[model samples]
Target chain A: MDLNTVKERAGPREFSPADDLPREYREAATRMIEFHANSEIMGAYLERPFIRQAPSIDRKLAFSAKVQDEIGHGQLLYRAAESLGVKTREEMLDDLANGDGKFLNCFHYPLKSWVEIPMISFFVDGAAMRRQATLRRTSWEPYAHAMDKVCFEEGFHVKHGEDILKELMTGSRAEQQRTQEAFEEWWPRIIQFFGPTDDKSTHHDFAASVGLKQQSNDELRDAFLDQYIPKARKHGLEIPDEPRIRERDDGTYAVEEGDLDWDEFFTIAKNDYEPGLGQINGRKQAQEAVQWVRETIEDDATTAGGHAPQAAD
Target chain B: MAALENPADLDEREREALETLLKRLADDEFVLAERYTEWQVRAPSLESDLALANNAQDELGHARLWYDVLEDLGFEEQELVYERDPADFRHATLVELPFEEGDWADAVLRSYLYDAAEELRLEALEDSSYPKIADRVGKIQSEEAYHLEHAQNWVERLADGEEGHQRLQDALDRLFPHALTLFEPVDPDVETDIVDLGLRDATLEELGEEWLSIVVPYLESLELELPVSSQVDDDTFEITEEMLPEKRGRDGSHTDAWADLHDELTHTYRDLGRSETTKIMEKPE
Candidate 1:
């Protein structure tokens, strides 16, 4: 299909792999879905350490399940991206490991302690879920289908994260204080999760025009702030004064875009942020270490006729 | 032996036998699950990562169920896990050994060996005189079936290629001796009590023999060597005393790796000075 025809026909689940789409449409969807797939992986990498560090068996189990779900989401999304025929899963993952792939800005920063967990799990994930809920109607059928499963499993994650927040807020003075401090530190980064406002975002116009993106950055950010600002207060976490947020007459919230560190966001966007490079290389080392295993399995799948049982001794 | 239904009325000997058996079961699952989490995001593929993570959660859930029974004897999750001495753990040393980086072979081979033994052990507990142990076995065994199948599939595929076969060989040789510790006795005398009191229908030696019969033939079929002798066609397998590791975990002796793992898993609990562990899931009904 031509660009004009594609733009006109864009609607929920309108596009599939069978379509003879123009290059522009395919590349745009691939870039958007690949970024999303990369984010799921990077996000899981960030949360993995906490699986070992969880203070309780139940919490550890929940964290492991959540991280596993993120990897599973990555799997679904890569397939969705691959459906565009623009890139393969291996290439996408390799780009992520090589620091050439871009993901969400929040994942670039390190998550240090248990107190910082709910910051990512609750606030960051909450923001992502707000955006993803809209993408359930995305023009790419596979991407939207993947979103169906992602949205189903993500509710548990957001709730589990919030549960951690609730626990920390009600904990001892030291625990509560530490959690609040973590909130203040992470608040700006969480706000940046929606990315720059509509005017500043480079790809938003084409993506939305094609129906791949259902809502603008400004709309998603405002929606997230409205839902989560009170949650922070209800949990006794004082919203950081900076990234000055204002409540509108309709009671929705808006972040002072000037207050967020866009330079840092863009640096992370370029995969040049110092800490993010560590994350990228760390995952790369892990992937490289397991390269032999992947090769072994891949070779076996091709060579073996059909999983014939090993000859009995 | 009659089923021992009430936890309150057990005498000293019965209590010791029951508690010792429970610790052995719980510690094995808990520690193995802890090791399995090392593969969370680092496994060979995303699908593999998810599979291993699911296995980790399954084993941990089984550990939770066993630990819950110990609470009937006045143990709390804090005392049972977070605050317990590493040396006090009664898991086989095989589960505690650290995974070599990029060693998918070790992960799969270890799972195959451990899950094979686990199937036999759980079956022995299926008719335990301790009613709680018997009741919980069915729930645990159902999940364990998938673990064993998953492990076998991976191990077989890994053994197919030249390099994978060698990797599987190396993993098997290193892991074989430690795997025998699965059947080591906590106290030789208490082991006898476990059988006599009907806490498990099979003795450790019996379970060990059955495990060898299954795993030896399976691995040898894939051209992997065992550290012990097995005459597969004749239905005879022997596990000599020398084949067992010096630090058999069942007796509260463990490799150095177990201590480091224990410290790491408990770091958060200790870091947060508050006294208790949190419970997110409702107590397993």
Candidate 2:
């Protein structure tokens, strides 16, 4: 109930909506979960086009299913965040549309070609899954529960993504060349996915102190690089030269923070970057277009003497 | 008529009729699923978005089943889909038309119209002469019942309000004619053989009349007007030449939109010079 007691009691799946949580803990948890939820939507938006552009029917079906899963993840997460009682799902989604919401930095860039798909689907999702696996023990019960399902579904996505990457890399020389180029362009943004180092992360201490965050920015980044770097090499993708990665004596990895663009990262974090703004407004316009449909259903429900039935999870 | 138990026993004429019927079924589901995926993150609410996406995947899975049946005729995925000519596709125009941004009315109304026809069509095929077609009908129909309910539920709700009613009316006017193309003949001789062989128990004309009998009354009950009321005679519906679109997809003719869509979907195959389409799921037994 009190902030000191809340801090002391924070542990894996320790808190739920039933708990009379302190405001600080709720707000922090809401922020973390909302960001995670927004990322799911934005990531889905990025992959939506490829559902149509996928070369084969099998690829198209997989892409559509994968994007659908991401939207489902967003649904689960927003419910988790709303259970915190800080902000409702509508408010969070509206915030995302209005450019006040933050998501992962990798989604801020434009995905132009089919070749660029695995860069986001495989490498970036692989990084996100690395962090998500640890969040299974998050202090918030609903958030961890959502992670339970998300982590299960995410393995398919990562595997499917790797399958696509393998197809491209083993194809003709031109296909392989284009895929490598896509990797080079997306590598820096993918590295920035973990955000700044432990020292530079502002909310890490408080979030970790509350058990909402299981790993620090530095720890997650190092773990991701150690695992995915070799996977990239195994796929014949050449890692970019800049953002120089250092191989530690323990066979771990670190990036030179100066080599990355924090200005651009912060700009996207604030939802002001141009291409990212396009992504945000595109979704906003779609939401506005279908406003009447929601109102119509709501009105019908009221006239029928009850609330509209919520969609089954 | 008895059902045909094995593909190996079919003569050339029966084989041609069966292939034509399967192409229509498979292409309609595949293309409609492609269009439905456009609504993934764009639906009005998060829950609705998920529902529509589920429907999309269901349609795609159904398409896979039909396409698998065609593979028994010695066709490969690449020859059937990726490298197939755009004009060779047999899907109806209703499924090919692109949705205007935020047009939830079109999405709902179109689904209502298509799913109603789907129900009748599936029932006609319940005793299909081809055992493969007959066996798969029950599985597909079970999933389709939910699609019909979801569409009907939305259409009734949308028609209840003035703005929603107006939107639904507009979508109905634009999409109704295209929906009729669903029953158009791919080949007159082949269609005749399809019925003569009992591949489907009813003819397209019979199915179209039954579909109109059902949808016409339902639309009128919601205070929605039918664009083709002039074509209705008593309880039976007949489609005239004017009621048809310029592009009858069953005849290997299509709108400009189909060309663009086909090219976009096949872009990856072309760019990568793929000789075969990837198979994610195993061949259906």
Candidate 3:
């Protein structure tokens, strides 16, 4: 399809693998979906340790299930990305392991303690959910289909996170104080989660024009702030003073934008931030550690024709 | 034998016997799940990560059910898990052993051995003299079927290749001794009561023999070593004491790995100085 034709047909679930589209559309969709898929993996990598560290059996179970769901989401998303035929899942995962893939700005930093868990589980995931809810109408049919399941399962995660926040806030004064400190430290990173304003975003125009991106960075950020600012207050968390947020007369919220550290943001965006590099290489070592298992299984599939005979007694 | 339907009706000796059996069941599931969570993002593939995570959660959930029964006897989560001494855990050493990096072979083989015993153990409990134990068996057995199948499937695939087969053999050799600890009695006197009172319809010896009949043949079929004499005498398999680990977890003796794991899992609870553990789900009915 020509550019104008693709533009005209850019509606919800309008395109599929059967449709022959321009290279620009396919590449754009592949880039967008691959980033989403990679974020799911890195985000899971960040939260994986907490599964072992969760204070209660119930909490540990919930953490394991949540991390599992994120990996499952990655599986779904890679298939969606691969449907574009631009890159396979193996290549995408390799790129992520090699520090060439980009993920959310929030995940680039360290999650140091249980107090900081709600910061990612509640705030950052809440922000991701807000953005993902809009993408159910994305022009790519498989991406939209994947989003449907993702949005359904993500509700449990957001609530589980909020429950953790509520528990901390209602606990002893020391626990509340520690959680508030974590919130203050993580607030700006969460704000940066939506990325730079619409006009300043590098790929926002074409993505939005082609309907791959249903909401702009500015709009998603505003929507997130409108919903979550009160949630933090309701949980007795004091909003951090920096990255000054302005509440408009229309009851929408906006960050001053100047207050957020864009230099760090851009460095993370380029996968060059020091701690972010650590996150990438840590995952790389883990991936490489298990490379033999993958190769062995692959070899077995070819030699055995994907079938193993039942063991004789 | 008549069922002991109510926790209050048990005499002191009966209570101790029931508690011993429950702890054996609960601790094994709980500790195994803890080791399984180490692979959440580190599994060989994303799909495998999700699958192993599901098995982890299932094992943890089963642990929850057993722990809830303990709560009926007036023990809470804090005392049962978070504040319990590391030496108090009654799980088998098999479940507490740490996995080597990238040891997918160990993960699958351990699951196979543990789940093989778990199925037989649950079957014995199906006709338990304790109503509570019998009541929860069906729900748990439903999930165990999937876990066993998943483990067996992975083991078969890994056993097909040269390197994979060698890894499986190495893992089995290292783990077989520890796996025998699963049948070790927490207390011989209580074990006698456990069988005499029909708390579980099978004795430790019976369960071990049954488990071997299933797993030994299966492993031999895949060209994996038995780690014990494959010889059968008079239609019975013997689990000699020589096959057992020095530190059997059921007797409250554990490897150093258990202490480190115990510290890490309870680190948050101690750090927060909280006396209570949080509960995210409703108590099982």
CAPRI accuracy category, model 2: medium
Instruction: State the lDDT of candidate 1 residue by residue for A1-313, as single tens digits.
Output: 8999999999998999989999999999999999999999999999998999999999999999999999999999999999899999989999998889999999999989999999999999999899999999999999999999999899999999999999989988989999999998999999999999989999999999899999999999899888999899999999888989888999889889999888999999999999999999999999999999878766665676645222210
Individual DockQ of the candidates? 0.60, 0.71, 0.62
- Model 1 residue runs over 4 Å out of place are A304-313, B231-236
Candidate 2 clash figure, as a count: 1
Please give the distance, in angstroms, between residue A185's alpha carbon in candidate 1 and its true position after superposition: 1.1
In order of appearance, the predictions have TM-scores of: 0.97, 0.97, 0.97
| Sliding window of 10 residues with minimal summed lDDT for model 3 chain B | B227-236
Tens digits of per-residue lDDT, candidate 2, B90-161, equal 999999999999899899899999999999999999988788888899999999999999998888777878
Which regions of candidate 2 are displaced past 4 Å? A304-313, B1-9, B228-233
Candidate 3 on A1-313: residue-level lDDT in tens? 9989999999999999999999999999999999999999999999988988899999999999999999999999999999999999989999999887778888889878999999999999999999999999999999999999999999999999999999999999999999999999999999999999887899999998998999999989999999999999999999888989999999888889999999999999999998889999999998998899888766766676874322210
- The i-RMS of every model, in angstroms, reads 3.9, 1.8, 3.8
* Residue A114 accuracy (lDDT) in model 3: 96
For residues B87-125, what per-residue lDDT tens digits would candidate 1 score against the true structure? 899999999999988988999999999999999999999
